[model samples]
Target: MALGKVKELVSSNPVVIFSNKFCPYCVCVKQLFVLKLGVQYKAIELDQESDGSEIQSALAEWTGQHTLPNVFVGGYHIGDCDSKFDLTP
Candidate 1:
């Protein structure tokens, strides 16, 4: 739900999930953040077929390129699951 389909509600909490309409990996990513880690966050879904979306813009701002399942914490883009593994340290 990008391109105004959803508006990001800013918060002091860092962890977040960049999701899409039908992605199992994204769902798992969100689960790990919420269920496993018990972290709350802002979930932004990208509209992949609508030419582009705000998610892409955010990706351009926070990261160098647009990618799905992008996660952030502590105001830093820590990437996906692999990056999250680094966060544990």
Candidate 2:
């Protein structure tokens, strides 16, 4: 997409995870990556109205599934928290 938009997303520390603020799986993912793994990330809660409509639209366009906890790392789609990280276990 646009470089400016991408820059906006990655403006966080290490990564950015788009979440729903309700899903337990999403919480687990963040805890694992940030608290446990010691990685820093700015999480976006989609269920909240704080973010603008453009961000919601952009998220739908990128992931194609309007589900909670859609993730992004370095501005790249990494799927949801559980599926993105643990495929074997």
C-alpha lDDT of all candidate models, in order: 0.63, 0.66
Per-residue lDDT of model 2, residues 1-89, tens digit only: 33345347765445787776778987887887877889888877767855535566777775674665667666566677445453232
Best by TM-score: 2
Clashing pairs in 1: none
User: TM-score of each candidate?
Assistant: 0.63, 0.66
What's every prediction's RMSD, in angstroms?
Answer: 4.6, 4.5
Tens-digit lDDT string for candidate 1 (1-89) = 44233224323446656678577877888888789988887776765545346556756565664666777676566776445346553
Q: Give the TM-score (vs. native) of candidate 1.
A: 0.63
Ten contiguous residues minimizing lDDT sum, candidate 1: 2-11
Off by over 4 Å in 2: 1-7, 11-13, 51-54, 82-89
For candidate 1, the C-alpha RMSD (Å) to the true structure equals: 4.6
> Once superposed on the true structure, which residue ranges of model 1 sit more than 4 Å away at CA?
1-13, 48-54, 82-85
Error of 2 at 17 (Å): 0.8
